[model samples]
Target: MLKNSMSVEFMAISDNERFARSVAAAFVIGLDPTMEEISEIKTAVSEAVTNAIIHGYNDTGRGRIVMEGTIYEDSVEFRISDEGVGISDIRRAREPLYTGKPEDERSGMGFTIMETFMDSVEVESEKNKGTSIIMTKTVKQVGK
Candidate 1:
């Protein structure tokens, strides 16, 4: 039987994108989530990882993104963290169109996409401590 919560850690590399999403999907599978729900979770995970690589690390080809998943009776929580140049202003980063790298074709929609895909999203960071994004989604049973 799966425990009330399951946690998995992974290094954040561009090549490991699929692996990260797979880990999150596995965690939610235990909750018996629907296909659509699974897709949403995976998308959210992808966005988080992308932000870690592109924004958190500034795409300088340094640092690693750490991802974790926690299962609960009614919800599954996932956190993506990275130790790199942290965001100076999270509020500005979350704006509708606030790309740190606009010239690179970045739409600045990472946080927005994450928030839209997941039920809830929380972000924490310090100047040199790194950044962490926590997201949660409640599972919906098919029948009573």
Candidate 2:
């Protein structure tokens, strides 16, 4: 629960990915997010949620993803977390075109897309603890 910012918490489930994105989009829209910003935010959210479902949970459909959004005065932060197998190789996961499941047509572009969309993206995970993605984007004022 972030003070002075709007926050949303949602359970992580494969079927809830779209719902999470929609919630995030609605939150950003309340903050007067631009059309482009909304699109980017949605994409980033999708990537993070997908990663939580695929990589974190290994598509077992037995884990949960906790997503939170904080709207600050100058920026917005989105945190997506999951309790699952955790990331065994952070370096490899961050690498472009590196997919743990190549047969699924994953494209290995989750982190890449997140980085390109948001102003900053940070990942924290433990072998058995869980994984968390903190993504931030600075809002541009209209009449500055």
Candidate 3:
């Protein structure tokens, strides 16, 4: 069962990445997460949003990114998606330090960071369709 949820759509621009991160942080704040948890969630969200804007849309700033956040009893799920060129290799993309755009100096740590921060990270994509990154983090409920 879902305790709460929110969905927002914004242009795939660099500036909106911060907005996405803020939204995710706000959504999970009620869970009474620690500073480290909040930072982790923000970083994960930033990485996902950055991938959508840079790799997914090729930084054209023309596509749209849909960010969805869902809260459960003990966890929060965030989905960041884009309607642009999709990832061709899910496995390769998830590999640490494996960047699809080496020319851009990208560290290729987006998925890695997301996976490290969240309890689970799932990626769904299709050629010329788009990519969706779904990540979940369970609140530790510290001191509760």
Q: Pick the candidate with the highest TM-score.
A: 3
Error of 2 at 60 (Å): 1.4
- Greater TM-score among 2 and 3 belongs to 3
Per-residue CA lDDT of model 1 for 1-144, tens digit only, reads: 234665555555676678888888887787888899999999999888888888777877678778877877768889889997888999999997799899999988888888888989999999888999999988895532
How displaced is residue 26 in candidate 1, in Å?
A: 1.5
lDDT of each: 0.83, 0.84, 0.93
Candidate 2 per-residue lDDT, tens place, 1-144, comes to 343445455555667788888888888765677788888999999999999888888887777777778877767899999887788899889999999999999999999999999999999999988899999998674534
Top candidate on lDDT is 3
Better of 1 and 3 by TM-score: 3
Instruction: Please write out the lDDT profile of model 3 over residues 1-144, one tens digit for every residue.
Output: 789999999999999989999988898988889999999999999999999999999999998999999999989999999999999999999999999999999988888899999999999999999999999999997857
Off-target runs (Cα >4 Å) in candidate 2 are 1-12
The local lDDT score (0 to 100) that residue 100 gets in candidate 2 is: 92
Residue 122 C-alpha lDDT in model 1: 93
* lDDT of predicted model 3: 0.93
- TM-scores of all models? 0.90, 0.90, 0.97
Candidate 1 stretches with Cα past 4 Å from truth are 1-9
Sort the predicted structures by lDDT, highest score first.
3, 2, 1
